[model samples]
Target chain A: MIREFSLNDLVFLLEALRWTVLLALVAAVGGGLLGLLVAILRTLAFRPANWLALSYINLVQGTPLLGQLFVFFFGLPLLGVNVDAWVAASISLSIYASAFLGEIWRGSLQSVSSRQWEAGASLGLTYMQRLTHVILPQAIRISIAPTVGFLVQLVKNTSLAALIGFVELTRASQIITAATFAPLTVYGIAAVLYFVVCFSLSQLSQRLERKYHAPR
Target chain B: MPLVDLADVHKSFGAVPVLKGISLTLEKGEIVAVIGRSGSGKSTMLRCINGLELVQSGRIVVDGIELTAPGADLNALRARAGMVFQSYNLFPHLSVERNVMLALKLVRKMSTEDARSLAHAMVAKVGLADKLSAFPDELSGGQQQRVAIARSLAMQPTLMLFDEITSALDPELVGEVLRVLESVAEEGMTMMLVTHEMNFARNVADRVIFMHEGRIHEDGPARETLSAPRTDELKSFLSAVLH
Candidate 1:
């Protein structure tokens, strides 16, 4: 007798896909805010603050996301910091995303011309005033396209959470495939779901790039 | 009291001196033109007066506020002095009106409605009334410079500094900007200009100073300096530029 794939199994995978999206949202929002702070600290003139921020960025980016998830999931228990799979996955993804996002934003902020700062100073604006009034507005325009593009990568990376026993889309597919003995069919559906979400985000980012190129 | 006074100003960048032992004084409602070769520190002198470039050793007083002192209020000093740059550094993201109104609203604390009306008037003065909504990139070089002038005028400063404002424009486009400046001079607005346009400098400036090797070489009436320069350097510079 041949083993069969059922609609009930596909439905469970679809349900888990929702959690994947929710986790991506939590990671993106949480990571984006923390990353902005890190970017600012890295650019500030204070010596110790700048070095501390750089060390944080280097540590997070040097380690692999899978390894980070492992630490957060398995190592936390030894320290008596017990947390559920969902909480562990979200926190791990947020840390992973913050490093990349912080670097990207720093590049954007530095891209503004030195002349803009000179102009602001000539007008006697303080450092913070110049940043808010003159520099950030221009830097934000240059940053939008790249920032949205990074969101797509963040969404796809959510699959790594499955390694830590999170029942997101990939984990759900693995469970179904073990029972049905149909790895190809079950994993194919999961790939399709991920592609749909990631592809839409990619298209949106491209459209924004084009719009930014068009004359105001 | 003189509106601006500089005593033995000295500035350098990384050991290469830009302005060395410069001193000058300007009374209210005076127009002085600063002339120099490309690297003679004419632009740096103008920048120092406005607090854009800090001097290493000097006493710079504008409207009785010592610019070189540690406790001086730079914003208040800048409020009374305005500068126009060669590149016409209007904010690209803001419209012409907002570009002019920014200092009015932010620095002067003018109400939005009042600042808007003042900005429109300044734009009209520069012959850009119809282009109030236009972005900086949409305008030509001359138009952009005029808008920059309007932006400065909106601040209602007591002294204006023009740093090679027309050097970046096309030859044909220079006249319109000069004409606006001529009318401004007629209104007795105190201005210190760094310019290469000898004719405009001769026609409009109350006094002209020739700078060389990071110091002033000659200072005299505009006609006397342009027609009968005292030194061979000024003579050769005029001959090469005019011919």
Candidate 2:
């Protein structure tokens, strides 16, 4: 039966949109923590740790996101760890985000002038003191724009979670369109919700860039 | 005991030797100027004393600490030996006050109030008391270099190394920075500087060590050496720099 795409359907989509937001938040926080570690390891002078970080970034980035989701979704069950789609989807997305964020932040850390380290050292600041007080503050300012830019990408990429039956915004839209046979209305609203989330992030990115980089 | 003692220090960048078996010493309160053509290792020698550059094989004892030892506490050594660079290197993100106060708070473990007062005093000494709140970019090149000096001075180091600190300044601005150095010298701070300023070297520095090809070619009283060069290298170097 082709029921109308009623208020009930709209509420369902909105609820699914909430899940989409939750997934992105989880991925960002998880990824951000892991990415910080990765960036530090990558930027350290120790070769073995640098190579380990680079290998992790390559492993995650080299594979397709969907492939990662599948590996976690199907592969986890094969190992007798019966995980749900949400588990699989969030884990895969976080790993995916970490690789890119790690690379972005590593570049930011390196972009700080090498002389800054020397200046800090000559002042008797310990290595950790230099990293935290002198280096990270400047690196964070440089990383702000690109880091938010990547968050937008992460939000949009959450749509791919629907294929694993995670029932996020896109998955809910699919169910609604199947019943109402209104692909245009269902997909259009989904697109707008994604736009709303992404546009706000980009706006925040610009505002932060201006605040941190303003000449004193 | 000498304030600084460098005995047979050797340093090379990869394959190219920069300092070749150099030995020198500085007494307390001595103002020594290192003058040489570029790549003659004047700057490298100053840096080696601060433990910024590790010598291949030598003994570097500064203010009673042996820097060439296998496990020397460089941070402890550096705190006692302040260095100002050619580029000023005033932390761009910090206000002048903060730049001067950073090491005081972190290394000296001073209370914030004490650091702030000392920062003010150091900035005044460098003649930038009015620009204490200004950022590095807002200040003129001379002002920024003065702030850099204040930043180092706030540490109350036993020795100060100035590596071509005025070489990057405009010719008119050079005198202001040099004047600040003169004041610092009057306070009886032990200073070692690499400079292209012949007049400043002659007037202010008590001793001039002229380097030629990674070796100290002449080390003598500044006025006598400047008036009568002992080596062809020193005479030619003076002509090239002054003319």
Candidate 3:
């Protein structure tokens, strides 16, 4: 049987692209803010605070995002929590991104030289004052490129959300393929959409990195 | 009464002794130059005064404030004792003016207008008024060091510490930095300098202190200590430098 590629299937995939991008943005912004807090606490907090932050990072990073999504979507109802697939996907993806981003930010913070701290302290700045005024400003410069690069990873990772039946781009492709019995054509379209989104982000990230490095 | 005093101060870093039974005093407005070979405890002694390096034993008092005490306000003490590092550790992200203004705004709680005016005056004092908007990486080594000096001066410290401030600069750049320091000393700011510039020690310092094996081996007036034949160590040190 000769099968025809339908414009209707293409339209469905294009509509699903909006959800994918929305989920990725929510994950990036929500996770980035929480990750900044975690990174700051991990580095600057005393014993118990540091321990708590470390445990949080370890728990998130140790388990798979798929497992977390399953727990949030399937397991939460058992505990009197009733969140739908979109909310579960957003929360799960955000937690997952926070772990990785937190680690990245902590490394950036540590990369700043000890002499900078000494200089700040010798100037009579309190610990918080030094961090806000001296250390974080420099660290933001060192961290920007890597942070933008991480967003591309975050965008691609949103595809995993399709496993929980959220009807994102990948899930929509599966539905279209099931209806028309044309797996290769539907999946190829989905792949191209993802490539376009992620490739553009990657290009933007590279441009930012170059601008940061360019001499004044 | 002495403006600064240390009584048998001792410091060790993981079993490596840096300062051993170091005791000294400086009157108010006195310019003391500390000279020693590398690893002879000169820098450690200066750091101990500002509580940057904790002393294992004995006491250090600055302007009647006990630095070795557990309850001392270290931030307050540091506010009074400004330090100039060899690397000119100005904040790279801040402009030269902001580098000078930071402590004034944060520690002193000065208003923005007052802080800006003081920072501007300080930048001019360092002879970098035109470079006020420049970042540390944009300035020459000497300019950066001068900005570092201006940053310290903005705090209006009672005492200043210099840890080989000019040693990191190019030879041609060294003189400009030393000239800024000389002007600071001439203005009667009390300073303790750890330096290799023998001529500066002889000309600008009120007293000269030589350290050997983590102890003060010689201490006296600058001219007598630098020029006269006192001990075999001092004679050999002078000869090594002069030759």
Candidate 4:
């Protein structure tokens, strides 16, 4: 006997959305801050810092997100530092976001023409001054569309957090499907919910892309 | 001591040698023009003096500071030596006012009011006061180059290096930029320039240097050099451009 999805199921999934939004925010704020550091280290002329940032980006991008999730959620327990699914998901997602965004930002930062650096340097501006006055301003303009695009990916990626028993949108949908035997109704709604969030963000990125490209 | 003295300077880009044992000197307030065909190391010599390019061997002294020394203060050196490029490398993101005001506020640490006023004065000097709020893209190639000149002049540098500053301008636009350079010259600014405008050199430069195959083939008073051809290399060079 299969039960139709009651309002309770819809309500529960709506509640899980808070976790989804919270996780994405945590990743964005944490990842954004650390990602700036990673981007700087990778782009700077200093060798050792560049190597360290390169390794960080490789380590994150080379392996599966699931592997990193377990390393934080499951593997960390063996070391006797207990962490909940929320903490582990936040940590894993933040690290994941940092590596990806750092590479994106590094590309933007490097995209500022070498001639721009020479112009700034020729004017007797120090490296830091050159970056703030000229390079970073141009780089930030180049970075906006991609950075916002990554945020949309990040929102969708939060669904993977449910695998670790975090009870986000996917997990909540799974629980409803199991109990009601209405995978069609429950999953359809879940899909709509995810689409709504991701689509809104994707549209925002496109709008911003157009806005940035529009002439002054 | 000369304001700038380069002694047997040699420079390379990876495997290709550009400036090979080049030597030159500029006294205070001398307006000298360097001329040569492409790949003759004229521009590289200017860059080395500004510390924009490093030499593999030999020495470059700008304003009594040896740029060859490892820890030489580049900013302090650059502060005294302003350079204008053929490409007019103005900060595209900044307005004309901000572009001229950048080094003043950041490097020299001038107050906002002081920087703004000085920037206005420099822009007016270049006859671009009406376009002070304009972006680089909003202006013509000639106007942009004038802004570049004003940006450099705002620092009140003791010496200015022009790397074919008029080469990128349209044929009609060339005169406007050259006129700005003329006023700058009239102000008694010490300047070293690489230019293809033979007439500009004839009219404005006190001295002329003709570089050939990484060496200065001919150098003398601008009046005499433009009129008489001592070397076949220079004679051919002038013949190629003059027509």
Candidate 5:
């Protein structure tokens, strides 16, 4: 039975938005930690580890995120591995973020010159020591902008959580519109919520870029 | 045995042979200059001395360690062998003092206070006492090269390899760096350099080695080699570089 749209419906959408925000936060922290390891491995030039990290990035980035979500959500249950939608969505989204963040950070690491490596080597610092004391500090400085930009993308990509039945903003809004037959009004507000979150993050990345990019 | 002994060390980059069976020995406190045209493998030889490049054959022993042998302690060998490059590859992101102190802290495990004091002293020795807090990009090319030298010197290496360190400097700036080299030589620091400055080689180097086609064509006392060349390659090289 069709029901009339009311203020309660908007409140429900806002409540669902909390999950979206939390998912993005989890993805950011989790993806950042894992991606840094991946990025470092990619730059280290160790034959096996480097090749494995590259293949991992390629496999994740080459396929659709939706396909990744299905593997965790729908496909796992058929093999008797029961994963709830919340866990499945989190896992897939984090892996997606890791792939992109790893690639972005790898670029930053490589931007540090070959001369830096030679200088560090001449100083007799071990490869790990050089990375920790010399290379990474510089890479982290150059990486901040693109890293923050990826976080903004992470925030928007969480709308896909709806597919796994996570009941985030998009899913909640869709639920409300089906009952009230108010698709435009319900979805427009959902769109606005995404815009607000994404716009602020882009602004944050820009501010970071300006702060670090001083003219020499 | 000499402090550094390369017994016919051969190196190639993929299919291209760069250093063709080169052997040399360096005694403590000796300043030897290796002069040659570009692609004569002078820089590659300098790199091999410090294990920057691996050899395809033959042997290299530095500071009692066989670098070409498996299980050689290259990092420990490199600890005592310092090198300065032609491009003056200073750590652009770090301050002059930080650049100098990086190895002391990381490799030597020196405390910050000790590293700081020693780095400041090295910087002063290089005549960059005023540029301690400045980034490399803020310094002139010559000053940056000196900072690179200071960075290597802070490690207190027993031997130094300078691969045309002053070649990238301006004509006016070249004097300050050469002066630093002269002082280092006088202080009895063992050094091997590849340079184009004939007068500096004649005056400062105890010996001169003229390389052609990846082999040493002439090796003798600097004055004798500069004044009286034995090979046609040396005569032509001296005339071309001088003129």
Candidate 6:
């Protein structure tokens, strides 16, 4: 159509960014809950539970994100589940985020000194009490940096949703580029929007880290 | 009944046996100093008494709780027996008062108000009353060790175990921590301590247990045991330590 690269196109891209933000939020919350379970299982001394968590982590981390998205988008129809692009993208991104977040959190939890456990035990704290009151508070501090880093990665990874015809930021950019014949302008603006999100996340993480680790 | 009873206690880490068939009894209000060379099972014996380490064979009964029984409630036993370590292991994230009060609130289920007052008193007892609001890293090693003692004391335990508590302190800082232990002894608290402080053993402890190669080489009145030894190992150990 060779339309003008106008304000309406910019508005459309901005609107598409809203979907990207929402998808990232859904993935984060879903992944966070599932990742907590994974981390606890991996850190526990029970062999069966540890093995189960390890295998799940390996399965998610070993496969490609695109393959997972494809499985959910295409494979679900074969199973008669009939999920749309939204469901498929959300599920696959969440699972992908869970494996990385789980491993990062498990490392943080275990990094706490063993002596701290003994100290808590000798003071008569129950296992759950020790975990909640002592271990988790310390581990939260250790986990902040890597966890935020993964979130930033997750935000950028939302672009992959466009491949499955989901109308997120990248897909919106492509639509605008085809109409206006302005690929450079459309993708450049899209890249800048991603930078804004990731940079703000990093800043927010630094503030949280400072707040938690500050001396009493 | 003895406050603590360890009968034919044996423990091993993987292939290496640490304590070999050790039998001991501690009467109420008795302060026993366990002295030995490194790797002599002194610390392990203290640890086993508090259920920190499991003994492969034999029995440990602390405050009438049978620790060797299957599914023993170790938390209950530990409530009656407090332990202090060489590194002080204070929850660094908490202030001195909170560190002392955490178990009181969580384990003892005391109200926050009650825990606060008890925390104050325990910190005062250790001569760290002024440092209540300070964090662990802000204090000197000796100060941190005193705070550790206060933290344990706040639990109102019947017996306390000290695992080389002053061994990690600077030479000058050792005196302050030992002084806290002396006052604790004066208050008639039953305590078992693994220590390298020979002089404190002679002066403060009611009994001395010298361990050699995972066995008790000598056990007797502290002054008597320090002055005159019964075994060649004890004589040599005393000479080597005293020198």
lDDT (tens digit, per residue) of candidate 4 on A26-87: 99999999998999899788999999999999999899888899899999999999999999
Model 6 TM-score, 2 decimals: 0.97
Q: Which whole-number lDDT from 0 to 100 does residue B184 have in model 1?
A: 89
Q: Candidate 2 docking category?
A: medium
Residue pairs clashing in model 6 are: none
Error of 5 at B233 (Å): 1.0
Q: Using lDDT as the measure, which candidate wins?
A: 6
TM-score of chain B of each: 0.99, 0.98, 0.98, 0.99, 0.98, 0.99
Docking quality class, candidate 1: medium
| Model 2 lDDT tens row, B1-243 | 999998999999999999999999999999999999999999999989988899898899999999999899999999999999999888877889999888899999999999999999999988889998888889999999999999999999999999999999998999899999999999999999999998999999999999988899999999999989988989998888778
- The 0-to-1 C-alpha lDDT of every candidate, in the order given, reads 0.89, 0.93, 0.89, 0.91, 0.89, 0.94
lDDT of 3 at B241: 74
Cα lDDT tens digits for candidate 4, B1-243: 999998999999999998888888899999999999999999999999999988899999999999999999988899889999999999988899999999999888999999999999999999999999999999999999999999999999999999999988899999999999999999999999999999999999999999998888898999899899799999999999997
Better of 1 and 4 by DockQ: 4
The interface RMSD values of the models, given in order, are 1.9, 1.4, 1.7, 1.4, 1.5, 1.6
TM-score of the A chain in model 3 = 0.90
lDDT of 5 at A112: 85
Chain B TM-score of candidate number 3: 0.98
Which candidate, 5 or 6, would have the higher TM-score against the true structure?
6
Q: Taking the tens digit of each residue's C-alpha lDDT, what string does model 3 give over B101-220?
A: 899999999998999999999999989999989988999999999999999999999999999999999999999998999999999999999999999999999999999888899999
DockQ ranking from best candidate downward: 2, 4, 6, 5, 3, 1
Candidate 2 Cα misplacement greater than 4 A, ranges: A214-216
Regions of model 1 farther than 4 Å from truth: A1-3, A124-126, A202-216
